[model samples]
Target: MAVVEGLLLQATSTGLLLGALVLLLVYYLSSSFSFKEEDNEPPGPKPLPLLGNLLQLDLKQPHESLCELAKTYGSVFKVYFGPKKVVVLAGYKTVKQALVNHAEEFGEREIGKLFKNLSEEHGILFSNGENWREMRRFALTNLRDFGMGKRGSEEKIVEEIQYIVEEFGKFEGKAFDTTQPVNNAVSNIISSIVYGSRFEYSDPQFKEMVNRANENVRIGGSAPIRLYNVFPWIGPFLKSKRKLERNTEKNRKEINGIISSLQETLHPDDRRGFIDSFLVRKQSDEKSGQKNSRFNDKNLLSTVLNLFVAGTDTTGTTLRWGLLLMAKNPHIQDRVHEEIDRVIGGRQVVVEDRKNLPYTDAVIHEIQRCANIVPMSLPHVTSCDVHFNGFFIKKGTTVYPLLTSVLRDESEWESPQTFNPDHFLDKQGRFAKKDAFMPFSAGRRVCLGESLARMELFLFFTSLLQHFRFTPPPGVSKDQLDLTPVSGITLNPSPHKLCAVKRS
Candidate 1:
């Protein structure tokens, strides 16, 4: 009877211990969830605890949602994506001031879980401090030697244009989707530099890589990916986010194979392409006491992949938008054709011709501004605590320089909502550069391929426009052509066939 009583006492003690533990857990959780920005922080819509503004934000197009909030909160405001707090700089002046005037303060790349998973901070795109500076300088110098923005590079683009023209001839002036052919042509220009060779459109390997790139972009920019970023612990349960991880690995492996082959054939004197150049640098560094250890194989792979991906999507989408907008706005199309015919003539158009074709340049700029491909710029981090534009932004605060807000700021453009080439044209009808025309972004983190992209867009757009006039397929009216992008991180025009009637 005494043993039984002792056992009962022990059970009572266990129950009290469990109860106390439960109370402790509740208190910790309650205290931990109390998230609030400092009093000196910018004012914004009040965010809920833990969830922050996730539910309130339109994750698909966070830029648009933020724009709506700016109407209430002003140019500079704070937002919470889950528990993570971000300060958004809206409109042209504010974004410019932060990215340009305060460049050093806001220079760091604000990497998220998804970006870290893909890059692991090895390449120029997601790196900071010494790594970014070294890689960017190397990339720019090499690209210049390879004829990036110069007349020497013009030959490579012109050669690629021939391939596109030949493929367009296969369409026989019938309605064909220009998406793949255009993508192939533009991508080959970069491939010739990266892989030292170009792939045929029929090549399965090339097609697979392009498909994977497009898919990765879609998934990476999706709502679920953002959710995974906000709540990284929940990544295991999200299928879309998991697919992104697999996609990242697949791209890395493919690039690695090409890099391996390049290594086998590399000669110090005969540097054929980017891989050869990088390998030569890596060897030089190894012998020089590792002064520049950033020139390793890992960085080579990541940088190559980043360049390959960057080279493909951004310019290709803009060109596609150019064609769609032209098809939709026939009057604009007619003006471009006239301008090209008068300035460039029927013979093969070149990058040099962009200067003479003012109307065409204006039209191209308008299309980019209207399409706004990269609506939300890549996230950036503050280098140190910054009191920017009347708000106390702490050190390492994530900053969203809303490119869409600047591109579509109501005060900056007379008709920001409408597709008007006049925005880029002076009252005298000359090509005029606007302070707000920042499609390539501003400051230090501007795309390394800006010059290359500019040349490609000019050469490809002119080449295609010189040869054929784009018109909507079948009964589709000009106004009916959907300008709204097929949703992704970048804006892609809806897949629609256009009749490329041969120019007489």
Candidate 2:
């Protein structure tokens, strides 16, 4: 009887211990779930383990895919590019709010593996903190001094426009690809500011540099490179990455040669252009014995690379798109020509003339809107934990301000998908600027060359329209001329030809 009583006591103790453990487990789980429920992270499609949302993304056209997702998930939503978590800010209001109102919080650049590999956190585009600030300030000051948007740049652009007209005359109403000549002409504008001189269209070194730079821009947005950015371990196996590296090395060597030649003849007292000013600053820093200065050769090379690629590509791409859009929409082209002829009267178009030419100005604005280059304005990062649009975003979260959504916001544009110049025109036909016109982006990270790019677009575009009537190749109808852009770091018009019939 004593033995049976001891057994019952042991059973009772075991049951009590098990019951206490179960209650503790229940409380812990409930609290954990409650915490998650309260966190209020932006909702997204359920991410799979390890892969995240990779399977859902269209790697080639991520901006479009993300825009589509925003339809279901609203403006602020989370997405995973492989294992990397990203919060996308869509539409005009949200993007403006994040980038403008909360600039400090969303101001940092998200230097992904690809950009880090390319820039090494050295140049204005990829670097952050003091390096970015110093480089950007120096670039802006020197660019202004060297005639970025002023009379000096105007003269250079006018001179370049003549060369472009001459090139078009050679084609003589025959369909020819506008890519090379247009790129060369547009590139020379930046070339004058950077190297203090322009390259002849036939210069092998200059042509190679431009070709390589444009090629890198194209490949940098390829599927393999995008995947390599997400899964860097696969970089070694990517032909695209290898080609990019080869092109980068070749371009760097060529750039270094140019810098060396410039250095040999650089006069601190007679600064010619941007590179001269930078070298002068470097020399001064060295003479002062300043330690840990950011003005070193690496910074110089990287900064030049940043400026060269950006200056050459974005402006050239936009100009090309302008021409193509004109060919595709001859009616709009007619109005532009009419406006130019009526106001400017075949005399040389100048920066001062832009204000008088309202329709032309409106057309240019609409062109930028329709082109929508840089659809996913370079990725940004959150600088601190914050509540945005009622969603909690942690510090260091990668944020993409989807320019595509903003440019095409239904609430912002009358005809979001259609190419309509009326979008920038008032009822009385005056040039009207919209608040959502953020082609150069907004806030601290806006394009360093915004002023120059605007000047270039207006001058080059008007000059071209004045000199030539662009049309689809013989036997191709205007409606058939595809407006579909080749996806890249920037959207490029697909491979096609147009005849630049010289105006009488």
Candidate 3:
């Protein structure tokens, strides 16, 4: 008994000593490392030691915290994520100046190990330099050539919308979760562009890919993901992190399998899917001896995969929010239904219908503005050392602009925190564009699928609202409309149940 007590005492003594040493070390580091608290640097909360302002940060809802910090630090300020300096641009004007006015200086994308590993510096989203330019050009050209922005694109979108409405109608009088069907509709639209066809909702591979994509997205902004980014060596120890990577690999394999099958069946002459067009470009480039051709199969696969990831959850989640918002504010839902009835009159509503439906358009814009999915865009890198608005953002530093803050800036909006569609409407009841509104971000690094995404949201929202009125389950009050977003790389609403009551 004496021996055991002696061992316990020694262990306790060692722990206390170690704790004291850590405290002393931290104090020393905090004092030694100089973070200039000058007027020039962007504003933020007081940072401490090696942890910086990490403890004060709310990883789940970073936008709210950023807005609070912006209040003290001003619209623009600097904060450190450990030893690294990150310049955060808050509010509309600051964001505009940094991302738009100084676009060239900040055009570089941040290439961390994980993003590079996933994209291999091949796809447009994470790739930079020569590869990015080449791929971006190709993607834009093909997207345009295949009718992305033109009326032809609208026809395709309307066709998909029709199919989606029909699918939703199957749940005619039943209360079914619309997430999968909405996701399928959005994915099919993009798939039509990429693969020239859409997969069945029941396809095992398609379902698996969607599941994996959802998992990866959900893991984003999680403590483990942030931890891994901060200390890469710790990644292997976290099983969830490993699971995320494994799942990503599995998803990639499934997507690649589809691409491989297409390659086998489609001859060089047949320019059907995006891959076919890419293969043709590859052959031409090979003949011309183009330097570092980026149109190869690997890039094609990664680009399509990126599309699947970016397109699926965002649109589906937005629809989910739309339904919830309508349910919570039945007045808004009735207004939408009235507009559809008055405008369409039992006829098909197309993308062109938005121009005629001011109330509906305002509501859709409000939803995007309020929800603000990708609040802080994928971090951008400083191409070279540059000084703007007082601070020197060093070369290779990551710049995370709180985009949602800009959208919801109280200085700009009347009811910044509330769901007011009037923010996008003028006194004339016409749609008015707000300079502060940038849900899809701005400048060169903005969402590549911005046009398509906008079209999809408009078509889906209008189509669904025209058919059915959304409501919470019986006995549930309107206040129960879940607005709590799940903290991930993308801000998703918490799981909630909704019933799509038929308009008739």
| lDDT scores in order | 0.83, 0.87, 0.76
In candidate 2, which residue pairs get closer than 3 Å at backbone N, Cα or C atoms, i.e. clash?
Answer: none
Best by lDDT: 2
Ranking by lDDT: 2, 1, 3
**TM-score between model 2 and native:** 0.92
Summing lDDT over every window of 10 consecutive residues in candidate 2, give the lowest-scoring window. Answer: 8-17
lDDT of 3 by residue, 330-436 (tens): 99888888888999877777777888999999999899887877888888998987888877677787888889888888889999989998998999989898888
Runs in model 2 lying further than 4 Å from the true structure? 1-38
Clash pairs detected, candidate 1 = none
TM-score list, all predictions: 0.92, 0.92, 0.90
The TM-score, computed over Cα atoms with residue i paired to residue i, of candidate 3 is 0.90
Q: Write the per-residue lDDT of candidate 2 for residues 1-504, one digit (tens) a residue.
A: 334323322323233223323433544454532112228899888875445676687767889889999999999999887567899999999999999999999999998798798778997999999999999999999999999999999999999999999988999999999989988988898889988999999999988999889988888876666666766765544556788889988989998998999999998999888999999999999999999999999999999998998999999999999999999999999999898888988799999999899888988988899899999998999999989999999999999999989999999999999989999889998889899999999999999999999999999999999999999999999999888888878888899999999888
- The true-versus-predicted C-alpha distance at residue 2 of model 2, in Å, is 75
Candidate 3 off by > 4 Å: 1-40, 289-291
